[model samples]
Target: MGKVTGFMEYARLEEGYEPVPKRLKNWKEFVIGLSAEDSQKQAARCMDCGTPFCNNGCPVNNIIPDFNDLVYRQDWQQAIAVLHSTNNFPEFTGRVCPAPCEAACTLNVNDDAVGIKSIEHAIIDRAWLEGWVQPQPAAVKTGKKVAVVGSGPAGLAAAQQLARVGHAVTVFEKNSRIGGLLRYGIPDFKMEKSHIDRRIDQMKAEGVEFRINTLVGDLPKDGPAAKVTNDATTTITPAQLQAEFDAVLLTGGAESPRDLPVPGRELEGVHFAMEFLPQQNKVVAGDKLKDQLRAEGKHVVVIGGGDTGSDCVGTSNRHGAASVTQFELMPQPPEVENRPMTWPYWPVKLRTSSSHEEGCERQFAIATKSFNAGTGKDKGRIKSLTTVKLEWKGGKFTEVPGSEQEWKADLVLLAMGFVAPIASVLDAFGVDKDARGNAKASTDLSGGYATNVPKVFAAGDMRRGQSLVVWAIREGRQAARAVDEFLMGASDLPR
Candidate 1:
């Protein structure tokens, strides 16, 4: 978009990070963003292909090339404007998004893709520093009320959009603070909570009401909510929400974690990723708890190779773990992908995260047969994991005979992905569910995001199952448009 041959002339410049030894000392972001000149050079790499597949690759449909061109020309003000036109929280995605757009970059066909994410990070940070990011409360009030259940990315996005469009939007969160998983499930090291707090402030300025420590739907007087971060003893019924608000939108994300049904699963010292991650996030925020979980001097075994598992590994290292090991059931993919076959698409290949760089052992194609309970000196806790090698054939895994092994583990965290939204909430609202247990609502343009129930709608993980923040944002924005259309004859809001 800048120099015709910028891609050929300039090499990719990735963000820098603090050394592992230094970064592990605290729960803070360590990635140093690209400099202005470096960001401009990287933006110049954008070929601005006639058909930009990166636009489609991004779930939010960000106008990537336009911003890249703007940044390349050092039009930083217009760059931020263009970025905000599509993305409500580039700051969130810039830090946490896996950058699928880069994978679909036209130049990625046979060369290093344009550093789209780094440029996005640069644009948003500069916008904040220059005081360009500000609230735009509607000039006129619509007198319409929308009740948003959940304070996760999807709920927050929908609430912000609706509030900006003059709807009285109230966001319900059960946690003590807002930002849902962003404030709890994620470690502060990957992305500090300040980003979410600032956005919350902006949203509040835009007239969005945030009811923290208030549950929208029912929660058992005592349930898994305690294990997570539930501070409110009060609950709001679905009927109350539907009756009070002109429209109701469900964005309460998938929270039903996939469990490992094996022997000794109930043993002490075994936990879910959400259970482990939130506690540390709270600790970093200056919260204290009795018998807080720590990995210090313990052999930690994290049972999943996804981002959540990687977070566990990094947190353990910070806790001064004696050793750490991660397990993945699927066989490892090649270190590099076949560009010709997988061009313009997310490729299947080995991905080593920054956390893996700290220090940890990784095992692939391994199945956990059971958890071995420790006794005697170790005392009624998880002592080891019994596993077996697997042979992948015909889309299923078959255990290899006589390939059993068990390793000592003082603590184990299950990092398997979530299955669906909390069942009670959906049931309370009487919303239909997909086979996967997510709320059932078609994405068809004619009646997109609407539930079978009149005046009620659903979006994000609650409807689509577990997904990235970008996808949640897209759903939230689209659902807002749908809700706006339903409230009026039609909507001027972007779809």
Candidate 2:
């Protein structure tokens, strides 16, 4: 709305990236954010659509048009204020969220959508550089204690909101570090760890205590689910939390990865993506690791075509793998979606991430049959795997006859995505679970986020299953409001 006709005058400007050759050498953010002038031009492209669907399209319902107008007018401080008013961590969403807001933009119906994510990146990065981001401690204390189990986006968002509302909040993390998924799951090439560190510092200044390496519930001593990253030295039970805190929020991620239970799955080098990813993250954080899973000089095969699989591709390339190949069970989507039919909604289209661009041979509609072990000296280690092509017919996949094949694979990383949260934590709390194994909780305004168990709540991936970080933040903020109302009988915090 800042420039009525600007949308017609300007073409979309995409963010730049470092050359693949130079970026593959180190683990660091490679995106080149838009300059102020470029960001202003991009923001000016926002049209005065009668109903801004982008607001609702965003999981946190960010005030998109307002921030766009502010950026167009070169109001940097105001832009960040609008951004933070909705999203607790624009740096995380700006870097990793797959901009559903842009997909719902009015301009996207006929032309390129506004570069909203890039503008957000510029705003937050600029705000940090200008010292606009600082601690916002409460003036008065409520003396009520709240326990947040998990330190990912959802837990962090909820803790910040409750702390700002004058409640004493303590976040418990099982890992040695604060950030659960953001610290270990995401590669540094996508987003640096320093972003999470600064936010932790700010939260500490706001009176939110973070207890790292603290497990609030029991975890399986051994199993596939046990492979989840955990370094807890202290374990607290549900009864202790219920007695000590006025409210308990379960915000842990969906850590139970889906497995391929084919023959020879027990072979060495066939590991879950989590098992391989966290080690590299620790190594990047300067934690020396022995027997680290390295892809160097190995034929790597990453199963599942998703963000996690793409991340594996990037990491494998960084490790100087001999070859990297990715497999997808579903058929490849169209290169471009039919905008006329799917306007104002997320569409199914082929996506090529930066990791895929680096180097990866991707195969679609392929299913693994079994992992094959090597012979003699290489016994017990995976050497290759059998696969079969599939054809979709009558809503079912029928294997193609005579299409069986074997491919060399010294390392097989299963990244088929997480199935649910670990069940032990919910069992410890005696919280009910949905059919999908996620904590059973509603999002209604009345009694929202409350579990069947008394004084216990659930949100984020723990409640909604695997989802975007933006959605996690939204659930966390809303859960905080719900808890506030439950504790005080009313709340003024924004949903």
Candidate 3:
């Protein structure tokens, strides 16, 4: 617990941000992090609430109040120790996580919640600055080998945990680089890739092997019908991997996007969110992209009101789009949640992203009817979007009469979210899948992350479907413990 009256004495302090006008010019993180003193004061706001809902609210069950108390006591190293005990990468979560912990804070009933996220950000950064963060090499080698297929947060967490417990861990990534979505899907402006690079270095120092450009699946005999990014000349077959590794953990993420199957879906201008996001991230990493997906001087319409949609808006703004508009099929939510009605659970409320602040017209209660492809020579390209006004009636969406309208647009980005993990990958491994197409695995203490297939396991988005990075890390850690127990008939690893 923190100071007895700290909650009453200290008001929540928020971290500052770079001006929109200045930040829009470059693809760099513009967050003005809180000063050391202010961050400590924010940490002091943590109260002696009998039940810490912040722990339950956090996906990884981070010891928020403990770290907050540590920080308030100016024990930066101890604060980070408390943080790292639960979260493998507090830096990533602190930067991007929506901080449901704050929502579940007791102080949030009438006052601002403890600035847990910012305190986390401050602790990890201080730990790094003070060189407290280092590779923890295993004391003894178990001679067990594990292959974690994915370099996202989940896979990374699992690999690190296994390696620290004396298992030889090798991470397989299909992309040319590691850090799956962190290296590709997320823009550098939101979080610098150096965070990932340094972590990779630390993992390497801890004796974990990283294999990039190694796709774990059958090769398309005739090559892809359309160009997709990956460097695997012949995809590493799952059979080969299973035979090579003692235990195989599939954490490849949900890559299959949910497509809008309306007319003109194949138009050249309409692209999935992943296709647009990774390209910019690559460009930011100094890769020369051929015919980059630029929103330059084009009327941009983004479908989906989620984080991916917001990302599209920010990228489009940087691309200098003529105008950016977002469409959401659902009705607009209230500005603030009624905390009394939904205390511990995450509530439905309007969320405006940093991208939204840059510039964008957001339309709720609207549905895309169809794409309007131009005539003649431009028949394969999108020219506009025809949308229909929608209304909620009897808890269902209904189209408004005579509300159909067309808006001219040169580009349309679909951020409609992912449906499931790629079926081909799961099929290759002969792993059973859930109804949602995610890898089916029981999370029981005995079987843990075991799949129907012997010696095979699943975690992260591949097992849980689309989810947060923090959840992925938690699943990865839990799966690692399960795998260790399976191999050794017991495990000292944290659950």
Best by TM-score: 2
Q: Is candidate 1 or candidate 3 better by TM-score?
A: 1
Model 2 misplaced stretches (Cα beyond 4 Å): none
Off by over 4 Å in 3: 219-228
| Per-model TM against the reference | 0.98, 0.99, 0.97
| Model 3 CA lDDT for position 301 | 95
Model 1 per-residue lDDT tens digits across residues 203-254: 9999999897888766544444335567776788888988999999999878
lDDT order, best first, reads 2, 1, 3
**Colliding pairs, model 2:** none
Root-mean-square deviation of every model: 1.3, 0.6, 1.7
lDDT at 364 for candidate 3?
Answer: 96
Q: Estimate candidate 2's alpha-carbon lDDT, on a 0 to 1 scale.
A: 0.96
Provide the overall lDDT of each model, using Cα atoms, as 2-decimal numbers. Answer: 0.90, 0.96, 0.89
- The TM-score of predicted model 2 comes to 0.99
